[model samples]
Target chain A: MIEIVSAERCVACDKCVLACPTNVFDRGPGGVPVVARQEDCQTCYMCEAYCPVDALFVAPHTHPLPAGSPLREEPEVAGAGLLGSYRERIGWGRGRVPGARLAVGPDLDRAGPAPAAGRAPAGPARGARD
Target chain B: MRLDADVLVLGGGPAGAWAALGAAEAGASVVLADKGYLGTSGAAAGGGNNLWYLPPDPGLRAAAIAGRQRLGGLLTDVDWMARVQEETFRQVNRLASWGYPFPRDASGQERRSSLQGPEYMRRMRRRVHRGGVRILDHHPALELLADEAGVVTGAAGLRRQEGFARWEVRAGAVVLATGGCAFLSRAFGLNVDTGDGHLMAAELGAELSGMEFSAVYGASPEFGNHTKGLMMQYATYYDERGRPLGTAGPAGRDLLARRLAAGERVFARLDRAPAALREAMRRSQPNYFLPMEKAGIDVFTQPYPLRLVLEGTVRGTGGLRLSGEDCATTVPGLYAAGDVATRELVTGAASGGGSLNGAWAISSGTWAGAGAARFAGTRGPLPPPGALRPAGRAGMRPGGPGVGRAEVDAFVAAVQERVLPLRHNYFRTAEGLTESLRLLDPLWEQARDRLGAAPGDGRTALRAREAAALAAHARWMYRSALARAESRGVHRREDRPAAGPGLAHRLLVSGLDRVAVRRDPVAPRLLTGAGVP
Candidate 1:
């Protein structure tokens, strides 16, 4: 099963989810993709392949390898962007650059303080970049 | 009441069925409990999962090419994701062939492949029952049974049959495939979804991250666009022409850069008639761009022109933070899966394989269930909470005639009219958000008046569930909207018109009534935004 998108990297775009066919995801609060129907996954890398930002991963089970093909040790399932492959060769970087998972967090100053009840907290910006 | 079983699966959807059968097949007694009739609720309950986003070999080739070019360096391994695709294809095919009557394609192949939750939920019920899993209907897990130190021991709940009856069941481990908080949102007065799993996890002290992010998307037109999760295949946008339109763009690395860099609203622009797009627009009435003809003047011909809606904080990301194969929370003996567990595997709609993919993750529940069983071996029995508490007094309030049903309809209409298509579109601003909030608040206040306790037997339970779901979903929508100050992904803030260079960071908050905020580490690195590296 795929780990939930990190608080920082997930923009809640639902791209990783929309590309799926199984209704594996549902809109959690704040529009984030929630894995509502997970058991239906067939280990097909469709989600990992279609995720613009590699936000998803699909791995085979512990079952033996299929015939002559070697069992994949660590499947790095890739995602396809919304634009078909044709535009890819043309290198259109304008609006076609799909997202990928990132290892980062929110820059505090830009986002302001987290809310308390209905008001913003007065603590130091904790997620700010050093 | 005492119930014994080799396996006790909470949800009756695909995952639950698989968990029960997997264990049952392995020679254990299995009991599956569901809030609704088996397979009648959830995505598969309506029908089978939608089409595979990636069509076999050809689709894979196309996606691979697009991934490299459109996504730049962001795409992950194609082979692995393809494997996932292959698995889902086989599973769905097997289920349909095994008597789950999906709509057939021209070649007689079942083609009901869609992410439509209702459709998919229906199909799962038919097939799973055939697989020999014991199912209990209309039973909701009221609470987890725990030991003196709070270690999870089992579950207690109400079986809504003739009356509100309490029951207890013992299990080694429990998997919470209860879906997400869409229902909860309605309960809390949010425009979007409820935080069901989030609330449940929190009550058990499971650490949650990503509440600040919600992934709102253009609902598939077929599904009336009421539910999200279908924006991955096509990139909807306007051309130089000022009309609504769309294109089958690759998933990554293309026309999105300019907007991402400039912090413009990124959404789909459909090419159909306005009337055809009305239903989708009504439900999510998203923000959109007018496709421009060559020189950016003439409107394109397509009328069902739709665009991605990013008005509020509809990022669907949150859950119990996990460290490894073990999905342990700060609290022991508790386990979660589906949307509630926040595991490390994810993909787009086609990429994610929708409902079919969920079946694949049942192993997590199996593992958790087994682990729970193992823990139970050493732990003493837990004391039942006696009686399930009444729907708390804090949540009880009378419906005031001040906000009538008509007002809610009008409010929904007004929001659809004023907020959507304009401010809620790809290009969002603080001012737009503020304006939208103002417009929505009155209706929300009125909706509150419509909320109250129902009088009756099990009917009240059903009503209460619906009410709670609505309240929870509403709360997230409202609070998330207020929290986000800039445009990102599905959220576009007009006042903060430019994408922050610091796109790598995120916002984290806590507290039920008063949320506390903080930022956790950036999630696993696979896709970097336009600039923020």
Candidate 2:
């Protein structure tokens, strides 16, 4: 579930609100979005990925973390640059190289010759990695 | 608000976007309504997918189809398999031409087979918007509208972002690309995929095929929701005592499920994966690793508890039955695409997983769109509002008094209890299936006569309908499963352990309160072509 939205780093663009599939966030005072319906968060990390300024911190728990949890502290989260880490990891934002180049799977084009009728292919299954 | 379009597409995943694009390209005005943000909704938006992108080599194509045919229990049509391959090839290249930024190989050859979900959906949304398709995000279709002659004409839904206001669209044809049901198993971005399309189409007398195959599951960390199977492909299983469980690969899931069902804890470590491939896996599916990283567990080195999350019809190969190559349902003016339509034509009794399903979404969406456009072109003008009747019955216009929150919650919980458990759904027996039906059949009646939300309570209303759909879906699945009487593909019947001869036919299910299942004989050759059976 989502833990925090950093006020200092936030640009108040409301992208998280628009990007959230489950409507977990609502527009807050000063244009920033608040985690209004935290229970509805599916922990899919779209809000964290869509945040442009690295303002959102979504804990990876499917259920909500306790309020007293240390991850809720802004300094603990922001100081470690944990906010919007998903975006960075996915190489989605500015100046990051596309991560698709690193993808590995069966080479369909060069999987040797086709197998005999009713027989399994000779090479590794093409879509096994998917 | 009221809108008019030549074609109205529901659900804004890969299928719906492609449908809208196909319709627009066919010179038809299109409107797409998504329950969530277009680029952030449905299972396809949440993870990576591999396409069944075979080149036009007959040898390679035949080999591919034959391989899957064996895996899919000999029910796949060779003609459909070849057609999907051709369409996926063309569409992937088209995406490249539109600057989709496909990854290049070591020799600088673009790899058009796989897609990174986030980037893929973002580009698809932009492409569809540029194609002159009106997009209404956060609009969930409540029901289909039918003319006096029982032909589908339009649909009504709620605009969740606009103060829960009601919205309707009159269209010459309606395409349901609403994906499939995950039953709110928290499987990544499938929260919006509540089997609404299945319920809506079924209400309109549309039949469902392969629903008994809706028992698909994926391994995930107990605390995380990502159910992509790629990483789990390398993991080794263990019991709570840290002893090796001796289970590996796809077949190992049955053992893991049995142990878990027996009240034993399960754990896994990705030690079996090649060290060189770890980085590539992380980079390819970054989200899959995020939860483990945050929990301070190095999935590569540390053993963590895992659970098999039910993906239901989302990854499963059952849904609204198709009647033609154009992806139209039995109901005229009502078409199904993506996971919403049964993938049995290409995948047969097996789950399409990522590759075949991704390809099916592209091919079916395109064909359904063009077909709907042609359908609309011949229908003259949109029917008047008075001539159209709302076909939603169970949840929207209940016969009894309105149901409360508790009832809706109970219905959903009851459904999950029957469908989510491994013992109940995975290792099925005749006794267990009959018991499940004994419970679910009554819930169907309650859904029809007793479930309703108060006026303007959009959230509760949506929940009521989802509960109805889940209940209805559960019945269709169990009914078909009981009728099969033999283990084939994902529908494992413990009593009847072997695939019975003369049982290779597909099961077609229809009806609402009294769900019915019948065997539909598979034609020797669905379409004339090379490699006909």
Candidate 3:
């Protein structure tokens, strides 16, 4: 769920509008942002992360229930932009790019922060690029 | 407001971009309009895909070209597919020159991956931005404007900037590239694919064909599009008892169905791929591994749960029927390419994603763009605005009162509930289609009466139109399914399990009030190879 905690703090940079892939936000009459497509939010935090004033709070769905679980129980898929294909479509653990699956214990929560994404993470084949 | 152009392109995806570029470069004043910003919108913005490239080896290129010719028993336009096949070599080269930075081997050869996505689009958008074509962002054409003589003059679209207002474009020719129908389907960037081009063209009395093949269903555990083994012969499947079901292919579908019959949950797991394959996945999809990381389940190590659902018609077939030598539709002054036109190139049971579609977007867009410009030169100036007519007096908030959010949501939900369920999906039967049509009719009725939006709020208006288009799209797919009494390719029928012995006929549908349906054989089969006449 995404919440603009303090709308007053918003400078109306409209960064969220540009950052959004699904276009969940619409500019209202006074340039106030409205969650016109709230149901479509994939919770990628692009909006929150891009918000300079820290006015937005985004709590992404946890990994307690696996994806592809029945609908209405929870969102079966994520929004289809930026991180959506990774978190929703390309099911990988530990890293965004392909590699030997990261070692995780039986308990799901202990799975640490994702291996650094975007810049091909250091796979077992180290120093292969430079 | 009035905008004049020699050619007007009504979408801004790869196809639309190339179309605009083609027309503008050919000295036609072209204006490309997109509902969102150009270059960064449509399926392309989803990111990291091939705009059609091949491995450096001559043998691999020949094999890929030979293999694609074999879809749906030579369903694609051979000339068109072959043309795109050769054109992509240059298209990839052009994308690379624009700083796409495609991953290469140690020998500096561009490594090729079968999976396609938005990376190519990202670079293509830069190229489009550099192309200097006239572009209008946040402007979606609401209706195709036609002259009294029935030739399309231009289009009327809505722009949602400060508030909602109408934008009109006067053009000698228009290219419709609004993509295909993927009603509520998640894969293949179906969210924005509301079949706008189909509805607008159909409103202008254009015909749609091969809609029965619109329901192509496949299984992908995490992400569907570009997932190598999801539908292809690559992934390993696990049944409810955790028994490995072997590699996925046409036979894997049988395994999937059998597991479903046994009430076994199914999953697709990727084997630990080597660095080359891993680099290939990253270069093509880039984000394919994120979902697994989020869930703490490694795809290479752990099994990912997959579901079988109908692919959006963007990957199947159904759109404005292309005719004659050019990519022009039956409606004159109108042309279509990419996902919005008849997919004669993606025939048979092959999945229509990645390089095939990427190539089509670039090549067909160029084809339609050049064709439209040539036609524009052949014709006189666009007719006066007063002489042009709206697609209809009713569909556009044309009624007594427009609908609100509630009615529009209800209409969308109605289709989601009625037509999109698996029961009414891939395995279409006479009874199931009849029921689907029955449920879809009331929603159509509701669309006629209540589908409306506030003027300034273009989002709601877009949703309302999509709701109507989704209904029409579903109706066409189901009606076509009912008309085709045999099973073939993606149009699976429980009662009729095999491709019936007859000429492969494309189902053509026209009109909105009383839809006209007909079957026309695919003349000039492209490949003319094994198992087909």
Candidate 4:
């Protein structure tokens, strides 16, 4: 899933090794990073962004519902407004219930009061479009 | 750095998090540690869709427990099963309170969107924060520290700071939520799963069962690497000639078996699935959909390639044995929960995802947390550092010798490639397992020497520690596989496909020096069926 274009460019700073949440990359004998476990890539792209050499190429990546943004793109929290979605989901805005729904599933679905009818139909992210 | 807690819970997955929550709620000074940054690690890193809580329907509960008993061979602890089955709703409610998003129908009944995504952990981490429990992110427990009498008083681990700082935790009680072995699985993009807790507990003479049973699953052969699992029920399978190939369950074992026997490249007819089912699946498991879209494989009009995913440790059996009492290990003051703990509650059932295990993580974790907190209440001060030491200093890495990153990687790859997955799993045999060991034992002899770390590389060094843990675990797993000559559920041996009536038992493993398997009989409980009226 991840490929280092040319090993010659790799300075072996080990940033890619450290950046991976899945421990996807292990330092090769020559100090260049290798994708020994590509199947576990998840296409998160953390290794690509973290590689200081800019030698990494992750194959045709898909945007991960933008959970919060760039786990593989930028150095930022991916699930940005995820907490707000949480509050809306359980009928609790800020630790307090907005409506009389008991903060459980059956109760919140019927909802005395709430945010909106739909969220990320695919996931809880605020939007599906960029 | 050194720190102390009344109860220290290892790992930050659902189990450890819930364990910490339960312990903190019980008024213990709890400290939670993880190898990865908490919340964003473990199998639940994405978020969990299936929250297999017990339904209020009485007959369903009886039938569910009975089904598991039939599959798992009556080893299910009904008392523990009853408590966790009922109490897991509290875990679900706690998640809801923290704003975990579970899709509900117009009728407002909760829907199974997907098995864990980032959302589940997002709420869990928030709860951990609110619980006021002390946190140590990026701390992986390497070894358990014991007093003169062999009682566990604390653990020694790496803090994973600059050059990987040495760290120590003095605890009144320790819970091993370190999870199971995933790196050993096929399709190896090696993550943090190297069976640390399994090896660690084994070193201290903990008993492990179900090692013969691996948590193998199926995925789209075309997109298996990039995706988790395609919503199989919504897909149709046809051979290259368009002949019907049998479908797979949540675990995919059935599908794999049929395909293997038929000797055909089966393609899932996702195009035939109704729009509503496809849409529902997409919303439930978005990650599965994103990859399909990216790969240009539309389930609506096209058939997708299917393959067997050998995730040995995912729902794989073989973990620290749980006492019906309090999830404690044979070692006093030490307990295990989550994947690190064997599936005692659902022992006789299929190890499917969703509510079965997701809820198990929360339920077992909750009980262990409270049980540990109570146990901690009676603990005395930790023994002096000098008094607490491993029995063997040089041989303390447990099963083998020293090695470096490359060696460890190669070893893991070998296990994934030759020793495990298709060859050693599902289709099992005494000869196959024995042959696997014949290849693995030499590696074990060389494993420690192979698992080494340079002075400067902390990340590799941490992996080195985990590699040693995995090497030790591999020995135990393979040994048990060879010893258990019968097939049941995931532990299907071709030479012995049918489980012998007498062989419906457990094979306990420890003593890495000799690597012995002690078979224990399945003692069926008569009076304590959870919902069987």
- TM-scores for all candidates: the values are 0.51, 0.95, 0.80, 0.78
Span of ten consecutive residues with least summed lDDT in model 2 chain B: B524-533
- The C-alpha lDDT values of all candidates are 0.40, 0.83, 0.62, 0.60
- Tens digits of per-residue lDDT for model 1 on B303-345? 2322333212222434455444434455566655544544223
Report the alpha-carbon TM-score of model 4 versus the true structure. 0.78
List where candidate 1 sits over 4 angstroms from the true fold: A1-130, B1-7, B22-28, B47-133, B183-195, B215-315, B326-330, B343-458, B465-486, B497-499, B502-509, B527-533
Docking class for model 3 is incorrect
| Model 2 lDDT per residue over B1-533, tens place | 99999999998999999999999999999999998899988888877788898888988888788777777877778788989999999999899898877777789988888887788899999999999999999898999999888888889999887888989999999999999998888877777888999999999899999999888877778887777666665677888888887544544676778888898888988777667667766776687777778777898888888788888887888999888898999999999999999988888777788889999999999999998998989997667876789999987788866777777888899889999999999889999999999999998888888898878677888889988998999999999999999988878899998999988889999989889999875552433345644
Instruction: Please list the residue runs of candidate 3 whose C-alpha ends up more than 4 Å from where it truly belongs after superposition.
Output: A1-16, A19-21, A26-36, A42-130, B50-66, B112-118, B218-234, B257-264, B272-284, B346-349, B392-398, B454-457, B521-524, B528-533
DockQ of 3: 0.06
Residue A57 error, candidate 3, Å: 10
Where is model 2 more than 4 Å wrong at Cα? A105-129, B522-533
Best by lDDT: 2
* lDDT tens per residue, model 4, B1-533: 88888788888888889899889999998889887656556766633334556666767666756655665655555655666667776667756666655555568765432234444564677788888888877687777877777777778777664347877878788888988776544332325566788767766777776666663543545444432432444455777777765543422335555565455566776544455444445544444554455455676677766665555555565677776557898778788888788774565424544445676788889888998898889977778776777522212342443445676567567756544456555566778777877876666555444455555555666666665566566667778777866666566668985777776566677755567788655454522445543
TM-score of chain A of 3: 0.45
